[model samples]
Target: MPTAAFTTLGCKVNQYETQKILESFEAQGFEIVPFDSPADVYVVNTCSVTQSAEAKSRQTIRRAARQNPNAIVVMTGCYAQFTLRRGETLAEAHLVVPNPDKLRTVEYVLEHFPHLKAQLEQARQRGETPVRRRSRAVLKIQDGCNIYCSFCSIPYTRPVMRSVPYQDVLEEARAMVADGYREIVLTGVLIGDYGAATGSGGPDLAELCAMLTAIEGLERLRISSIEPTQVTDHLIELTATNPKMCPHFHIPLQSGDSRVLKAMNRPYDQAFYLELIQRIRARIPNCAISTDIMVGFPGEDEAAFQNTCKVVEQVEFCRAHLFRYSPRPDTPAEAMRDQVPEPVKSERIQQLQQVAKAAARRYAARFIGTTERVLVESRSKLSGLMTGTSDHYLQVEFAASPSLAGQLVHVRITDLTPDGVLGELVALQ
Candidate 1:
């Protein structure tokens, strides 16, 4: 059978889309392989979220070409879309599918390689089992962002606003549950904006979660990320009360300084963000609050950076994704004065990284000796132990058989590892 490999860069939306495209390939009788291995075809779902992301995207494309010199390399996602929009080309990619045509990637593949179509037909005749990956599935409920943050290029790359219909979402959730997926991560460009512009007659995000939780076999539902301003009281209450809703919120706090937030066009301030975290913690015990923090924005001086450290100290996020700001072409932030020097950016990132690490350790320490329900995802390579995620979104490692990969089990947290918590299998709960 012909083999294909897919690698995704950037956010959960891209991850979800890559999964969808992967399934499309399997439907056409393609055997999925690891990205590092040689394959007949390679697909790179690219990201242009930052300069580093774009560089990585290019690097991955080149790696794919080198992995199998004769393989067909396809590039899609934000970076590819940006390149195509600017009338540029990636010489490494055999085909470049724009963001708007991302869903039709498989079609492009079959069209470009007619012999692959014949191979797919032959595999169908043989009725061989198609290769699959992932125990947890990502379901994209919405797409496109209207919030044009000054530092972001996503709004420009994915400008259209639309929501998947409520019926379609429910149907897909049921299908995924039937396929033995215990968890579903709901993803989108601006997920909180669901049901606003498209008039898809779908339920709002909260209502959609409520509906999804009712699926009999659905063990967990995770919201990938949400704008701080878009996290509503209804969603908070629903997550607090719903057993299927994972008590984990990943709300991006790009910067904690009020002036930085304003310049970045974020709707919430440090005060609002702090209060929101307090509310979530108050309502849901052991809830893990994760966030994204961008250091070294255009005007982020010592005072602004200090404010961010203060917020990190206050919130004590369980996990913080820290990165230095990279100017995107044509964005307002790119033209803004007071751009921090590279050395200053490096210094600030180091300081913030220490703050975030300390905060994470402190938060993880609080859960020591507590029992957590962990849905076993896979085994850890570092420690050779069964690994999974707790309802609170903590990475947990315990001893168990491979058979327990998709099962939820009770685990007693004994120690905090560098990445997450180490636990022992208590009982299946």
Candidate 2:
């Protein structure tokens, strides 16, 4: 059988799309292989959220080409579309599928190499077995963002807003649960805007989540990064009340400084953000809050950066993705004055990382004596122990039977590791 390797860059939406694309290939009789391994075909679901991301995307494509000189190298996703928009091309990519046409990559592959159809015929003649993948799966229910954040290019790349139809989402949820997936994480560029434009008679994000949690055998549901402003009181209540809801919210806090937030076109300011976090924590005991914090942007000075640090100290996010701001072409911030120096950006990132680390450690320490419900996904590579994520989003590792993988279990937190918490298996749930 023909072999294909895949890799994804950027957001949860991209990761979810890549998984769907991978399944499409597997359906066509291609054997999936690790990205670093040589294969007859390679697909790179690229990212262009930042210059570094695009550079990495290009490097990944080149690496795929090097892995198998004669292999078909495909590039799709944001960077592929962005590159063409700039009238540039990646000579390394044998096939460049547009971001909107990403899921059709397998069709493009079969169209390019008609002989692959014949290869599939032979593979089917031999026989096959379907394999259930990861215990937790990501299901993208919405797409596109209209926020037009000053520092983002996503709006330009993925301007079309549409929600996956109501029946389709629930049907997919049932299918995933039937496939043995214990949890479903909903992802989108603007997930909270799920049912607003769709007049599909579908439920809004909160309602959709409630419906998903009702699926038989589905143990957990998680909502990927949502804008702070879009989070509603009703949604908070649903998240807190639902036993199946994973007590975790990945709300993006791009910047903590009000001035910076305003310049970034973020709807909420420092006070509003603090109040939102406070409300969620107050309502849901020990709920995990993770965020994204951009370190430098045009006109962000020492005071603005200090305010961001103060917010981090206050929120004490269980996890924070720290990144330096990179100006996107045609975005408003690109033309703004007073761009911070690269050295300053680098310096601040180091400082904020230390602060974020200590804050996360403090948060993890709060649950040291408590038992957490963990969905055993896989074994930890570093510790060679069974590992999975807790309901509260803690990465907990413990010793258990490998056969117990994909089941929910209770783990008593013994201590905090550098990455997450080390635990002992208490009971299977």
Candidate 3:
């Protein structure tokens, strides 16, 4: 059988798409091999989110080339889709399938390599078994981001909002449940804007949640991320009532200062964001609310930085993904005046990170002694311990056999650490 390996970069949507492609390959009698191993084909699912991400994609492609010079090196994803301007050429691949329909990519492989036809036929006759995914399954219900934030290159790379048909999403969810995936994280670039592009308008995210809740045996359903403005009353109410929905929300709060927000082309302000948080907390008291905070955007000064810190102190996010705003080429914010000094950006990022860590520690401390439902992810590489994430998304570590992986178990948070929560397995129930 022809051997194939894949390297996926970027968001959960890209990862989920890679999995589907892998399944298609397996169905066509392709022996899935480790990415480092020599293979007949090497697929690099690229990301162009940041300049660094694009660099990593190139590095991975080079590594694949080194592993097997003769192997078909296929590249796809955001980077491949927008490589024309970047001047990147997939010269390594015998057949370059740039951003092809994922399922069609599989068929293209089979057609190109006619020698695998017999093997594919036999595999098809036997039918492919549902592959079990580790810990969390990222179900890509939607794709593309419509909102073009000034600092973002994602909209340029992955323009247009396209949601998978409602029925197709349901079918994927059911398949994931059957494959023993306890947690399904619905992922997309702009997931909140799901049904706007499609004329169906039949099912918004709230309705999608309702349909997902009906799927039996699915223990947890989580949204990867959503904008504050998109968090509708119906969505909040549904999350409050749905037992399957995880009690965690990661909303991006780029800046607290209204001036910075306007410069960044962000729709909402500090007041709007704080009210949204209040509403969420009112509905679900123990919800673990997290956010993305970008420090050192163009023109930010001491006052603006202080305003962010004040907001952080007041709003008290469970955790914050602190980022130093690096100027991406061709972004609107990249050309803006009063660009923050590299030294200043670095200093502010460190300060914000410390604050974020303090907040996370405090949030995790609150869960101590509480028996929260955790889905076991993997054995820790550091100490050979079992680790999992609580329903509220706290990383909890405990002693357990490898057999515990992928099982939903209740673990009582015993101690809080800066990195993760130390826990004791209370019961499997």
Reference-based TM-score of each model: 0.89, 0.89, 0.81
Per-candidate Cα lDDT values, in order, are: 0.89, 0.89, 0.81
Candidate 1 shows a clash count of 0
Off by over 4 Å in 1: 33-40, 63-72, 85-95, 110-127, 131-134, 156-160, 196-202
Per-residue accuracy of model 3 over 1-429 as CA lDDT, tens digit each: 567888798777788888788877876667777687898888888877666577788888888988888787777777777685566576664555667665467777767877667755666677744333356777887777767799998788788678888888889889888877788899888889877456314799888988888899888999988999999999889889888888888899988888999898888988999999899989988788888888889989989998888788766677787777878879999899999998998898888888778767877888888899999977777767898888888988998887888899989889986587999888995
Q: Could you tell me the TM-score of candidate 2?
A: 0.89
lDDT of 2: 0.89
Of 2 and 3, the candidate ahead on lDDT is: 2
Q: Write the per-residue lDDT of candidate 2 for residues 287-373, one digit (tens) a residue.
A: 899999998899899999999999998998999998889998899999999999999999999999999999998899999989999
Q: Model 1 over residues 173-269: C-alpha lDDT tens digits?
A: 9999888788999998889998745754858899989989999989899999999989999999999988899989999999999999999999889
